[model samples]
Target: MAAFARRKEQRLSRPDPSRKRALDARAAELVRLLNARERFCTASSCDGRVIVTDTDGTGIQKKNCTWLLVTHDPCVKDDVMTALEKATGDVVFKFEPFVLHVLCRELQDAQLLAVRSTHCLEVPLSHKGTLMVSEEYIEFLVHVANQKMEENIRRIDRFHKGLELALEAAVPADTLFPKGPEKSHSVYMHRRKRRTAQEQADPSRELEPQDDAESSLALFAEIML
Candidate 1:
């Protein structure tokens, strides 16, 4: 009886090469079909509990994973909580309150589909693309970014100078800036004129005064502001 059992075990352990080849061929075919498809993802809150699910190939339930790609079985984990981490070697979706719909091109453009309850919902990627971000608009954004950067530099320079002046006079930092209506350009210009009238003002600092060094510095400041 023992000899008969051993012989039976030996026959079962022998490799079945032809069957293995058939299985491999089937897997290759499935992979090709899956690759040609794209998976769409969406996030929404339903009721109190978040339901994260996936629908593939005409809105059928495909494999869910750490990644939510159009993939075969063998998911990331054996079970899932809020979201499943899929290691299907497909695109992974982070564990979140979201759902993904995997659809073929026949359904629509891959980007336009999102998962609804029964049917996969079509997210309209349609746009008034005519009012697009033109080259001019792109250039405008760059210009605005540069202008803001320049303004920031001017602010830093002004703050540094104000700090130095405050230290020299042994005054509080806040004293460098006049408050209320005195904050305006007209007020600053008025104060400058008064200082000039008092002669305590540096004649060199006068706006149009022929002091080469101060006039050049003032011109540079004006451009910066």
Candidate 2:
């Protein structure tokens, strides 16, 4: 009865995959549109965000944050978690005590996959894809995920622009960060250069969002076409 009561409590409190799917089903059309857009990001989106903190010999630190926020469609998250669970017949998640925090069942390097939500610094086991998953489907998810990210970046860009404009107008930039995507993992950006007092942006510069945005969308359309 105690076990039963505990299970009931979890069922009430958590937003499991099934609940996510049910809600996602309501916006299947939007999902299809997003899947088309994500494939355009030349900047790798699937890997977890790896924020690099540089400590020069004397220990004065400089930080560079990579915004590889791979927002997910509910159905894709459900299917991937489901596949991982099915492939390994266990409740293999962080919440499960005794579940190895660093997994190596079907993977080699743990630095590849990341969960977006933790506030601490930790690396995770990354896997490319499971058996028999079609390229078309993965591409579909990539497109949608990229689209969602593009939309997110747009808001971020706008907020930054708003800040610049506000400074120009002497108005306080009270910009808001959207809460649409979950921060499951940190983007791992290889430190390409040391930060100077003048260098506040990321040291390793990837293609700007606008640079590859159109090409990515076009490439996805070509594939789908």
Task: Report the lDDT of model 1 for residue 79.
Answer: 31
Judging by lDDT against the true structure, name the best candidate: 1
Clashes, model 2: 25
lDDT of every predicted structure (CA atoms): 0.30, 0.28
TM-score of each: 0.21, 0.20
Per-residue alpha-carbon lDDT of model 2 for 111-164, expressed as tens digits? 222212222222221222233345455446444444444444343333334323
Model 1 misplacement above 4 A: 1-132, 170-197, 200-225
lDDT tens string, model 1, 1-225?
355345444533555443123223222322333333222111111111112233332333354322222211222222322232322222212211112223232222221222233211122111221222343543443344334434434443443343233223222212455666433333223443454575565555534432232222233233323
